[model samples]
Target: MIHPVAVIGAGPFGLSTAAHLRARGIPVRVFGEPMVSWRDHMPEGMLLKSTPAASSIDAPQRGHNLVDYCDAAGIPRLVTDEDIIPVETFIGYGEWFQQKLVPELERVRVVSVDRKSGPGGQGGRSGGGFEIKLDSGELFTARAVVVATGLSGLAHLPVELRGAAADGPTPTGPVSHSSQHHDLSRFAGKELVVVGAGQSALETAALAAEAGAQVRVVSRGRGRVAFGAPPWEQPKLRPESPFGRAWSLWALSYYPQPYRHLPAEARHYLVRRVLGPLGAWWLRDRFEGKVGVREVARIVRAEAQDAHPVLTVQTLGGRTEELSADHVIAATGYRVGIAAMDFLGHELRTQLAVSRGTPKLGAGYRSSVPGLYFTGLPAAASYGPVMRFVCGTEFASPRLAKHLAAAHG
Candidate 1:
């Protein structure tokens, strides 16, 4: 029971962090299924907005990137910026990465994580240690814990659509979040209304349309649905960045540590405005003419009428209209809130400080509670929007692993 570190996820962040930690001669245990979110949560036929080079999970070990996986697996490589990655390919790459770097990864879920404080308990940290309860009914102790659960419990639903059912959104209900759908073919021949203009909303609409469903997308009217330009279409003046060719994006993508120094207001604004609702360049061709996009339209009310979802929508200019659909899908995207992490025990949850429902992380993504770290979506509030993407693993994994190795020793 000399486990020094426990990683509570097996996504890109978790796998990368564990790989780095193990590389540093640190004893660690990783929990959760490999690439479960991308494989199970996101709908099939969906392509990642990130380019191939940006989608790789970084680690201390060599030959574990997406390109390496493709090369080893004898698959054709799409190395260009315009080459959009498919969800299936990404999932396969992630699994390969896990097997090569963190093969001992446990597929069980971590049910509860709580801080256990006592002297000389399991020879963890000097003062106290952490107890982790797995879904398999086994208990374990570790000196530190890293929470890299990507997008888990962070799905957001608009208030107007929440009233469609008493029990809330479901796969068979009148309203459901886009993350709940693994296949859009079920919506075929049905009248579908999708809200939001982000990649998820636009792509979900496109998939539903391709599945023979009549799809209509509703935007809040704050901005129009836009698409990222290809490398050639981008301006030549600005240098390249993982996000785009802008200096601001370049700075955000490369140096996420500086983001914490800015005023909270500025940081929050950039997070919301930088990577706003937009579609991938490849998605435009499939989405245009195939799906109906209603910008400047806001859903004011939603109700289930005769087992169907009906929405009263209003335009920015004050015009109101009602639209009825067989089902409503809220592609509103994720909202990071620490409270959504129901796996944290009450005592530990109370001790971890938070701001705006997200952990106020310090150096190395550590929460207020010592030895407890959080990354991925939960770290976005402190690390900027770059942490919202897979490329962030390059910046966070090494730093976090180094920090944990030093802290535990």
Candidate 2:
């Protein structure tokens, strides 16, 4: 059967896309379990880095906002000066959105998507739809596709860590990325070392410390940085109000041409300056003294030593030290690459044109590959860094729905 649109990855972006498409009277088949990544990967006690107001799914009216959901549920509507929104709350909010607004989603995994041949050759018709092949061997055609498989599916671990685990069964002590960490009980009373200084790294370290493990964090940079407080200008920036402060920032910061004009070094520098050094306020009190932060150090190598792993690390003062730990946790971020997706057939994966390892997306989030489109973090480079945040759906959903409607109409 042919649907007007097929939305992949049932996270916040995918569900939002589906909701908007449905609202536009377009038929959409959404795949994957709702909030699967958030439910499985994130630690239980972790709080959201952003606020409820800033982290909302794109809805037409203000009635469905996160603030309203919290109020209806009798949960705290206003955040404490120290407390950021918890991950559990955000997940609940997502579930609430899915149940109330977007309920027509099918929990299936899409293995591959290929362009179909039409009556004419090569390029095919401009609006010709494409086919999606599912894991259950089901085939469905759609004029457009939206890829919202978020950060959960694509984690980046160190090369040495991957090689060690590849030789045999993955050891309980060998898990590298934060996405792989589920339970804290396993590391109790053990010497644990965590890498990276991002929010994930700090949170994981704190959890490990709370689990009674001897925890140490090895950071290549200075230290964990955090945002001072929920910026007062955020509420005024909602996308619904075009002339608001948020929209103005979005216009200046997210527009492609201006961002592209900045040198890569400049962009990195700006991100480090503005968004860097920011973490949840609660984290500072929990991890400050308990989690040992080793700055200006790099893990040069890692190898199994006496049935455990020992890392050769270089400190900022040009001093070399070897530290042995019972377990190592790498909170390193994700690698966005089509090569990592084994489900894609060689031909189809290669055929899809890419820009800096991400699928090149049109104005409507549709890729050069007719039916396939990519959203979320992968779209950030093209659409703007805001795409990496949940707020991006406000812009992505409506624009994508219009494209699908035009193609199917």
Candidate 3:
């Protein structure tokens, strides 16, 4: 009956929550390779859209921020808000945070998490805790489970391109999502079509061109792709949000707790639109002309021909255009569908109430199930859009840890 709190992920939310729980003298077990998603999925040489100050994992105690890690490790410090963070440095910083705080993080994969059957019956929620099984064949029970798995099972590829994209054992094919690539150099001397207007799609196109690929960005928007306003033009009246500055950004970033009080429709709308789509200001120099942008374009059909993709797109003014590329990269961002998380048993998934395919979280970030909780991107519907960024750990970690400590004590 010695059940510890289980944290399923070692990213910003999981690492920070476990640190706070340990600081409160609570027994906890954290799993997943530290920052595995950020390390493995993001393309090399890419820069973070978030500034240095906002790109930190929260710790209940000080001395664990990005600045402290940079200073301690003798890495060049990011001294100003204007400084853009590199992906590699952030990954290293996350490892440093994990080592210094939640060093007990297990690198093994979690196969499944199921609700243990109680004396009442299998569907009953009382008495028995969670039964967690790992890939290594080890099984453990937890008094409470915190799921902070970031966006592991949520890469979104558009249905239009799925026919040409093979997401199987060998993902090498005519189409793929941006998340699957770590090096853009693989596309060198080849025609590449990148979809979407967001940072991921735009940046990938830029990197592909820089790597000597014939790159073009195809955006579905009727308007030209946008870049963030220059620093001086960013108004001071609106404080910075995770994505950028706006009055609504100020409200959501400062008031995640109150976000639940707002109507579900309003919360969902803000999450979808606030951080809509824009390339970072620094990236425009490389992206503007080096990468061809087919704005006001939509893919009408995608098919495989000669081991490559041939796309027929509907352009603005009711014209049709056919383009060929060695591969199509869908940089469409993640969709938070709890059912997509196959690690959760069917019974557990069915038992939890849902909002727009995401788990409905209640007090202390707990899901509809009493002892199960969720955080990070999946909590955006219940918390706010801030949950999608590393900075959200500041609000989520301490709050969730304190609740778990008191509930289980």
Candidate 4:
């Protein structure tokens, strides 16, 4: 069967896009397990930095907001817990929303997407759509494709470390990115080294410490930056208050129109400022003295020492030291470049085009390549930094749905 819209990834963005399309009476086929990456990768006892009201998946009119779900489930709406949306709870909410809203979703992996051509190199009609090949060897065609694959595909490790891993496994024992370190039980009582100073790094350090490993955090800087500090605490120029704030909180709280209206430069600036920095205040108290912190140091080289791994690190002051640990965890971050999406394949990736380091997305989130669109984090550079959060769907879904309706009609 030929579907009008095929959404890749069943995470928040994919589910949101699918639900919106279905609501508009557009036939939508969604692939990927609902909250698969979030469910599998995130650690237990972890909490989201976003508020419940701001982290919802469905539209406000639909009444499936996270607040409603928490209330029904008897989860307390405490201020202390406000910043602590459990990963499981969020995943459960996504799954619940998917089941209740977009039930036609298929749990499958999209291997590649290619444009279909017609007579005279017409390359299919405007609404002629394209074909999607699944890893299972199943083929399906759709008029449009929305990539909601989320952040799983884009991991950002240090350049030197990435290069070292490229040649083969690190000579100094096992070196892996934090995103790949899913199980901690195996490292129990082993010395573990974690790099980066962001929330992920801090959390991984805490987890490693809890696992009875000698955990040490190596970073280019030190000190804990709190997450979600009171708006008044920000610099006056970028204060949280409306009169002095660079942008209105109300405008950033939702998605779509507000983001669409933001200037490309402003959106780019926001992404660079927000996503690049590290803040670990939420877990600071729990981690102080418990997880060793090495600051102003860089991993110059990593090679195995006997069976254990040894890292030659250089500090900013030119002081060099060799540290040995059983394993190295780089909680660096994610790489947002479109090249990271392997499923897009070579031909489509070349045709999609990029702007300001992000995919050049149209108003409907469609790429230059017809029928293929991008949403979520990859679209943040165009849509605004809020696209990285769940709240983005509020605007993204409706806007994309309108485009789908227009194209399908």
Best by lDDT: 1
In the range 268-384, model 1's lDDT, one tens digit per residue, is 788888888989888889998999978755778899989999888898788988889999899988888878899999888888788788888888888888789998878988999
lDDT (Cα atoms) of all candidates against the true structure: 0.87, 0.70, 0.85, 0.71
Task: Name the weakest run of 10 consecutive residues (lDDT summed) in model 4.
Answer: 239-248
Structure candidate 1, residue pairs in collision:
none
Q: Please provide, for model 2 over 1-409, each residue's C-alpha lDDT reduced to its tens digit, 9 standing for 90 to 100.
A: 4446778888888888888878887777888989998888887777777655458888755667778778877898844333467788888888888888778777778888766566553322354566789888898666676778888457877774553344532336444667876676678899888877777888888988998888988777565434243344346437522112355455733454355346555544443343344565557788877978677456677777655777777888888888778877878777677877655567768887775566666667766766667878777655656676787788777777777677555
Task: List model 4 lDDT by residue over 1-409, tens digit each.
Answer: 4456788889999888888887777777888999987887766666675655557885525667776677766876523322567788898788888888888888778888877664543232443467789988998777778888888768776665653365443324367776665566667788888877777888878877877778988876442333444433555665232111445554454434556556777777777565444543466666887888887556787665555567788877889888777888877777688777877768777876786557978778877776677888888877766787787787787887787677555
- Candidate 1 segments exceeding 4 Å error: 119-124
For candidate 2, what is the total of clashing residue pairs?
A: 7
**How do all the candidates rank in terms of lDDT, highest first?**
1, 3, 4, 2
Superior candidate under lDDT, 3 versus 4: 3
lDDT of 1: 0.87
Which pairs in model 3 have colliding backbones?
A: none
Clash count in backbone of candidate 4:
6
- What would the TM-scores of all predictions be? 0.97, 0.86, 0.95, 0.86
TM-score-wise, the better of 1 and 4 is 1
**How many clashes in each structure?**
0, 7, 0, 6
Ten consecutive residues with minimal summed lDDT in candidate 1? Answer: 119-128
Relative to the unseen true structure, what is the C-alpha lDDT of residue 384 in candidate 1, on a scale of 0 to 100? 94
Residue 208 displacement in candidate 2 (angstroms)? 1.7
